[model samples]
Target: MAALILDPLAALGRATLAACRTIGDVTLFALEAVSHLVRPPFYGRLFWRAFVEIAWFSLPVVALTAVFTGMVLALQSYTGFARFNAQSTIASVVVISLTRELGPVLAALMVAGRIGASFAAEIGTMRVTDQIDALTTLSTNPMKYLVAPRLLAAVIALPLLVLVADVLGVMGGWLIGTYKLGFVSAAYLKSTFDYLEADDVISGLVKAAVFGFVIALMGTWCGYRSKGGAQGVGGATTTAVVTSSILILALDYVLTEAFFAQ
Candidate 1:
């Protein structure tokens, strides 16, 4: 009986210890990446390539998601507010909802799904195929050459994506309001602008930056640490996406609380 009880306890302790070690390792890795960012060898071409991959290529999906979200949000807001005779508030609601919450969160989740998995697959494959070792042999720092560019691109791209998302979302609401709901185009746009504070937008952008960092960090860490071979690479890719997505949602709540704390 005592042996059984102690065995489970021991297993739990080991799992807990492993989790702590992983957290420590990830923290150190992130610090190292940041330190490398300030050092020489900026890798401009890689940075530009990553920028295009992350930002420009991501536009179509982001635009579609944002516009449709805005339209649906406008309809929902009108439905709820109509009961209270507050239909005019729909524009403000849609804009604020997009800027303050939906825009950054959804965009980050989408990017994490796209880029996070890609990073893991690419890097994990490198680890398996010995390409990373080759880089070190050639006097190239893999962290700078491979990781830094992607990290910087994600940080830069996510905020821009969120900004575009904000605009498209608001435009979606405007289109729906004017065409479907009989709202005056001029009045809806005016209300959206009037009630949407700079702080709301700024806070979302700030969240976007943090989310971008976390997404890249998770993806790189998973891929770099992958073991085995093809199976390991697949597992790393899936883990990267799942972990990045969960962190994005969890961090969104923490950021919202921080931004709105009374």
Candidate 2:
């Protein structure tokens, strides 16, 4: 009986220790990447390439997601508020929802799916192929050359993407409200503008920056540490996506509370 109890306790202790070690490793890796970012011989070309790749290539999906989300939100709001004769508030609801929450969260998730998996796969390939080792052998810091640019690019790109998504999402709501729900275009615009404070947009942008960091950190962390060969790369890709998504959601609640709680 004592052996059974002790065995489970020991297993739990081991798991806890392993988790702590993983967190430490990730923190150290992030710190090292950040340190390299401020050092001499900054890689401007690499940064530019990463900037274009992250920001430009990501716009289409983000726009589509924003438009469709706004449409659905407007539709749902109409459905619910019609019973209470509060339909005029639909415009306000859609704007606040997009600017304060959904736009940032959804845009980050899309980027994590697109960029995070790519990061893991690309770096994991480099690691498994001995390129990373070759870089170190040649006196090049892989973290500086590879990780920092990507991190910086993502931090810049995501907020821009979220900003665009915010506009497009609001546009989508406006379209549905005016065309389908018998709302006056002018009134909807006025309501949306009136209800939108600068902080609402700023809050989402802040969350976007943090989410961007999380996405890049998880992606690079998983890739940098990925083992084995192709199968390991695939696993790292999956892990990066899943972990980034979960962190985005968990952090969203924490940030919302920090910003909005009483």
Candidate 3:
């Protein structure tokens, strides 16, 4: 009985230490990546590729998701307000909710699921195949060549993607409100514009940037540390998506609190 109890305790301690070590490694990697980003021998081609992949390639999915989300928001808002005979508030609700919360949150989650998983898988494959080691042997800093460009691309692209998402989402709301709900187009747009403050838009962009950082960091960390073989790569990809998504939601809450804590 004592041996069994001691064994479990030892396992717990080991797990705790391992967690600490992993966190330390990720922190170091992030610092190194940032340092390399500002150094010479920059990889312009790699940066452009990553930017296109993370931003342009993601446009269709983001636009589709945002449009449907706005349409649903309008429908739901109209239904809820109709109960109280306040249908005029539908435009304000749709715009505020989309701009302030849903647009950023959904876009982040979508990109995190898509881009984060891809990053982990690609990096994990490189690790498994010893490509990363080859780069190191060739005197190319893996942090600069592999990590920094992607991280920088994500940081820059996510906000732009969110801006597009916000516009498409509002347009979706406009369509639903005017056609499905029989609201006048002019009045719908006016209400949407009137109720949406500059702060709301700014807060969403801030959240997008934070989510972008988290997604890229988690992806790089998971991929850089992958071991074993194919199974390891697969596990890293799944972990990247799950962890990034959860972190995005958690950070969204923290940001929201900080932004609107008054």
For every candidate, C-alpha RMSD to the true structure in Å = 0.9, 0.8, 1.4
* lDDT ranking from best candidate downward: 2, 1, 3
- TM-score per candidate, chains pooled: 0.98, 0.98, 0.95
| lDDT by candidate, in order shown | 0.93, 0.95, 0.92
Model 1, 93-130: lDDT tens digits are: 99999999999999999889888998899999999999
Model 2, residue 174: distance off in Å is 0.7
Candidate 2: C-alpha RMSD after superposition: 0.8
Per-residue lDDT of 153 in model 1: 86
Looking at model 2, residue 241 earns an lDDT score of 100
Question: Tens digits of per-residue lDDT for model 3 on 139-245?
Answer: 99888998999999998889999999999999999999999999999999999999999999999998998888888989987998899999999999999999999
Inter-residue clash pairs, candidate 2: none
- Cα lDDT tens digits for candidate 2, 1-262: 9999999999999999999999999999999999999996689998999888778999999999999999999999999999999999999999999999999999999999999999999999999999999999999899998899999989988999999999999999999999999999999999999989999999999999999999998998999999999999999999999999999999999999999999
Residue 197 error for model 2, in Å? 0.2
Name model 3 segments beyond 4 Å from true: 1-9
Tell me the lDDT of candidate 2.
0.95
